[model samples]
Target: MTSTTERPEVEPARGGTHASGEPADDLLARHRAVAPSWTSLYYEEPLELVSGSGNRVTDSRGRTYLDFFGGILTNMVGYDLPALREAVTKQISRGVVHTSTLYLLRSQVELAEKIARLSKIPDAKVFLTSSGTEANEAALLLAMTYRRSNQVLALRNSYHGRSFATVGITGNRSWSASSFSPLQTTYLQGGYRFRSSFRGMDDDAYVDACVADLRELLAVATAGDVACLIAEPVQGVGGFAVPPDRLLGAYKEVLDETGTLFISDEVQTGWGRTGETFFGIEASGVVPDMLTFAKGLAGGYAIGGVVARGDVMDCLDANGISTFGGNPVATVAANAVLDHVLDHDLQHNAARLGALLKDGLGAAAQRLDLVAEVRGKGLMIGLELVGADGYAPHPAAAAAVLEQARAGGLLIGKGGLHGNVIRIAPPLTLTEDEAREGLGVLLTALEAVDAAQG
Candidate 1:
C-alpha cells in the first residue's frame, strides 16, 4: 500500500505553467470558463485523476489514493478489469462502434435480453439510452403515456437525474435547478427517516405514517389520475438514505388502486450494489412498473435504459431513437460487465464487504461526535456529519474530513441536501483489507477534523 507521506508535495501551478508542462490549474481555468457554473467539484484543490487500476487512482500530481467513490459508483467491477478490457478491445477491432438504434446490433439484443431476465418485471422489455437522465426521461414518458396523466409522485430528498423533466421530480433543492417542467410532481415524505416528521417513531410506525401521508397527499394534491411514483430504493445523491423495507410496498398498494405506475430509479442501487438482491427494490417486495438503470451496468461505459412490462414499454406511438444508445461498443461492454459480475458473484461479495465496511464506519462514528449517522446497504454507505449540537448538519466538517481523507490516500465522495454526508461507495470487488485500510484512513481524518474544531 502506498502512503501519502511518501508522495511529493508538488505545488499547484499558476496560470498555464507547470514543472511537467501540464498545468492542472490551466485545465481547471479552461473548464471553468466553458462549463456551467453549477458544476460542483470536490476538494480545496480539486484533483485531476490521470489513471486507475483496480480500486486505486493516481492524480495528475502523481499522488495515489484508494478510490472508495468508484467514479461516483460507476466503476462497479473496479477499474481496468482484464475481462472488460478484452471485451472492449475485441469490439474495437470489429471497427463498428456506433450503429444507432436503426440497425439491429447483436450485442444490443443480447444485453437487452440479459437485462430483461434480471429485471424481475414480468414480460420485460427495454429501451436503451445514453445516461440515467435519459433512462428516467424515457420511463417518465412511458408512465405519462400509459396512465395518460402528467401528475407524478416522488420521495422527499430524492434525486432522479439532471434532465429538465427529471429535475422537476427531484425533491432536493440543491440538485433541482428549476421548477419548470411539464410533469406535475408532488413530493412525499418517507424516503428519508433521519430528518423525517416520523423520526422518533419505530420502523413499523414510520412505514405506516409514510403510507398514510402518501394516501392523504394523493387525495389532496392530485386529481385521482396520477401517472407514476418514481423513486430510488436507496436514495443515492440524497446521501444514501434507505427508507423502511415496507415503505415502497405500501406506496405500491396505494398506486395500484389509482392505476398509477411505480418507476424504480435503480441508477445507483442496481446491479447488486445494495447486496442480498440484484435490485434494491427487491427489498421492498415490489416489482415496479418500470425500472431505470445506469452508472455501473457498463463498467464505466455510457449506457442507460428502462426495463418495463411489454405493454407499458410499447405505450409510445411515436418513433424514437437514441443516437448512441445500445451502440455496439457500450452494449458489448455492458454484457461483459454483467457476465463478470455474475460469474464471480460480486453481489455476494458486496454483501459481505458491505457488512464489514458498515461495522467499521459505525465504530468510527461512535468515537467521533461529528458523525451523526452511518447508514446504507452493501457497498453504498454514507456517514453524515453533524455540528456541535449533534443533530444540525456540519458541511464544513464534512468538507474538512473529505480533504483530510484525500491527503491520507483515500478518495471518497460527499452528498446530501446540506452537503454534510460522506459517501463511501467502493467497487463491489473491494476486499476486506482495502475496507479496513479505508476505514482507518477515514477514522484518522474524522479525528483530525474533530481536533481542529476543538
Candidate 2:
C-alpha cells in the first residue's frame, strides 16, 4: 500500500486560466496528515468539492464542473434537488429525526406503499434500510431464513455489498476479501460476452454452457443444498457489464429445476435508472422471488433500500427488523423522490437519454482503437479501455482518462474486475442537452489521454 505522502497530487492550472490552478499542495498534504488513505481510492482529483447544485459541482477554488458521475450513480435527480431539500427540511421540522422501526411511521408506510405500487408487483412488501448494503444484507438473510438453507449461489463478477453476509455472497474477491468467511454460499461464473472463454459459441450454445456450469456448481459446490441464486440484471461495479439476454432465461430455468429461489440485486439499476420498466429483468420477462433496490430510490437525499415480494417477505419477522431501518425523515425524502420521478416521467427520460448516451459512446468506441466495447442498458453504460499492449485493464490509461474527464468538466467512474471499464450512469432526469455536453467532455478527455500517451 502506498502512503498518502507518496501519492502524486495533480496541480490545478494557473489562476486566470480556464482550469483552476494546480490543486493546492497544502490541501493534499493536510488530507494525508488527517484522513485515511482508503477514502482516496474513490477519486484522484486535484480540486476539493465545496458545494453542488443540479448537475454541477463547485470546487473550493470557485470553479464549477458538470457532475456526470452523479455520486457513483446514486443521485438520480441531481444534487440538492429543491423538492428533496424541502422534503428533508419539512421532516426535520416534525422532530422525528431518528426513530427505530418499532411502531408505525406514517412516512415509512407511505413510501413503502408508493414503492410497492410503482414496482407493479401486485402486492409487494417493502423493507427499508439505511444503505444498499443493508438492503442486500437483509435480502440475503431473508433468503437463507425463509428457505431453511444456508447455501446461496451468486454470479462470478457480481457486486452485492460489503456487509458480512452480502460480502460472503459477493463474487469480487478484492473488495470482499475481509468479509470472506466460511459461509454456506458458492459462486458460479456468469456470462460476459466481452471476455468469455466460449466466445466463438453461438447464443444458444452459450446459454447451454451457462446452464451446465451452474448445474455443476450447484451439485459440487453447494452439494445440492443451494437456497437461492442471486444476480444483477446488469452487473454494476463488476463492469457496466450486461450479460447475454438468453443467459437470464437459462439461469432462471436452471434455478427453477433445482428449486432454488432467484434474487435480483437491482441496488444500482433499479428505480428506472436502466429504463425498461424497473430494470433489465423486466425486459427479459423473468420475475425473481426477491428484488433489492437502493441507489436512485432516494435521489441521494438520504439512504433508503427496499426488498419487494409478498410471499417471500412473509417468511421473516423480528429476525430481519432493523433498528433505524425506516426512519421517518428518510422515508419522507424517499416519498418525495418517488413522487417526483413518477410525476415527471423520469423512466421515459432515462430511456431516451440512455439511448443518446449509448449511441454516442458506441460511435466513439468504433472510431477509437483504445475503446474495446460499449456495453450495458439504458443510462448504465461502460467503455472498456484495452491495455496498451494487451486486452487487460489499462489502469494508468484509465486514471489518465478519468483525470482528463474531470478537467474537461465531466465525471465518470471506473469498474470491472480489472478496473478497465469507464462507467457512465447519470441521473434518470439528465436531459439530452446535458448528455451531449457530457459526451463531448468525455470525448475530449479520451483524446487528451491518447495525446498524453503519444
**Top candidate (lDDT):** 1
| Stretches of model 2 off by over 4 angstroms after superposition | 1-27, 42-47, 317-320
Clash pairs for candidate 1: none
TM-score to native of every candidate shown: 0.95, 0.90
RMSD of each candidate relative to the true structure: 6.9, 5.9
Which candidate has the highest TM-score of all?
1
List, residue by residue over 1-454, the lDDT tens digit for candidate 1: 8757667654465665343456546566767877988887898788888788988988777788999998899999888999999999999998988989998899999999999999889999999999999999999999999989999999999998888999999999889888799999999985677888789888889888888898889889888899999999999999999898888998899889978999999999999999979999999999998999999999999999999999999889998888999888899999999999999999999999999989987987897888889999999999889988888999999899999999999999999999999999999888889988998998899999988877
lDDT of 2 by residue, 1-454 (tens): 8757676866543434222454334566667777876555445646677678887888776778777777888888888888989998988997878878777889898888877776666568988888888888777777877778888888888898877778888887656757555467777667456776766678788778878988777767776657788888898888877777778777888888756788888888887887867666776678777777887777775565655578778887665466777787778778888888888988888888888889988888776767888887888888888865536667677878888888787878888877778889887778788899999999988877766665
User: Measured by TM-score, how close is model 2 to the native structure?
Assistant: 0.90
Worst 10 residues of 1 by lDDT: 15-24
